[model samples]
Target: MPTLPLYRDDFYLSTAEAYVSAVHDDGAIELDQTCFYAASGGQPGDTGFLERADGSRIMLGETRHGADKSIILHHPLELFHSDMLKNPTADQSAPVVGEKLVLHVDWPRRYRLMRMHTACHLLSVVCPFPITGAAVGEEESRVDFDMSETIDKDAVTAELMRLVNENHPISVTWITDAELAANPGIVKSKNVRPPMGLGRVSLVCIGENSAVDSQPCGGTHVSETQEVGAIHIAKIEKKGKENRRFRIRFGVPE
Candidate 1:
């Protein structure tokens, strides 16, 4: 069944009520609707816990998509150490289908990721180069550009901070799949494209009227530029003859 991705509409929603639609033999639980973000793009999946009727918690290690993008699978933390469901102890039974639960996101970890992901977007705006690769992390993130131009890290950091200080509103808008296909230039990645076939694509817009930047993305980000806070380009490396990797970190450089 296609799980309702609540995060798409509300990134700040950390808790949500959902019914267990299915529970796989491997211990992957599916929900009718979820705020838990499934791993996509360069952002990691959300890790949290689910609360049952009895107030017992089911610690989820990560949220991921199943066979399709719409099918979200929540993997329990216990699945990592051992298969708790394989031999259900009387006290620790697996979550049954149709069970109602409350989802709780690991807010601190998620907030860091949100800040770092937003910083990556700001980096792209400052560089204005085709992104070859990227990764959103808790402490540091990297955005690789498909350019050979030698740029100063300090200069890039200054530009990123400028945008952050400007306090631009970060917002999301949806575009139809056909509309996205019509406007290929909005995509910044050189090799990777935004997830399609789900009917519509999300456009992450910065500034009042997307004056700074607007591109196709499905990753979660902070609501405002100022929320990115104290980010700097820690390093820029030559990955290839035509590729430069910029490392983004939180805080002022020493």
Candidate 2:
């Protein structure tokens, strides 16, 4: 069953109501709709709790795609009982099929990741190099570029902050798979290509009319560059003959 991915439409949605459509033997629960973001494109899955009718909570370790992008699974981490495998009725607290629950995302951690992910986009804008790889983290993020030329990290940091200070608006627009195929040059990552076959791809546009940058990304991000706030390129490392990794961290450089 395809779960409604509510976060795709609203990045700031932290809570949503959903009903369990399936319960896997391994304790993974599938919902009819979810605000949880599945682990994809270098961003980790959401970790939070599901609220029950009795006010009890089911702590989820991770949210991920099951089978495909359509089947979103939420894994319960805290209340798993080994006996439940032998006897499905053993764990009374386990989410039952057709049960309704409220999903609450860990906002503070998610907000940090949102900020860092947005910073990675700004870094790409400043460097303008073909990205080889990237990872979004709460405290720090790294974007690897297919470049050999030596560049000053401080200068990159300054450029990133300049974009941040400018407070460009960030918004998402959808494009069909065929539309993306026609515009391959818009993609910046050399190794990772945005997932296709989903009918539509999301273009995260920064700045008015995408004056700053626009690219296909599946990860969540802030609404404005200023929300990225004081990001600095902590270091740049030579990974291979042509690859260089730029590390981004929050706060101004000391």
Considering every candidate listed, which one attains the maximal lDDT?
1
Quality of model 1 by C-alpha lDDT = 0.91
lDDT of each: 0.91, 0.90
Task: Give one digit per residue, the lDDT tens place, for model 1 in 1-254.
Answer: 89999999988999999999999989999999999999989899999899878766889987999998989999997522134446455356788988999999999889999999999999998999999999999989999999999999999999999999999999999999999999999899988899888899999999999989899999899999999999888999999999999999999997
Candidate 2 per-residue C-alpha lDDT over 1-254 given as tens digits, one digit per residue, 9 for 90 to 100: 88989998898999999999999999899999999989888888899989888766788986999998888899998663445568666545688889999999998988999999999999999899999999999898899999999999999988888999999999999999999999999999988888677789999999999999999998899999889888898899999999999999999888
Model 1 misplacement above 4 A: 79-90
Candidate 2: the clashing residue pairs are: none
Q: Give the TM-score of candidate 2.
A: 0.94
> Which residue pairs clash within candidate 1?
none
Regions of candidate 2 where Cα sits further than 4 Å from its true position = 80-92
lDDT of 1 at 127: 91
| Number of the top-ranking candidate, with TM-score as the measure | 1
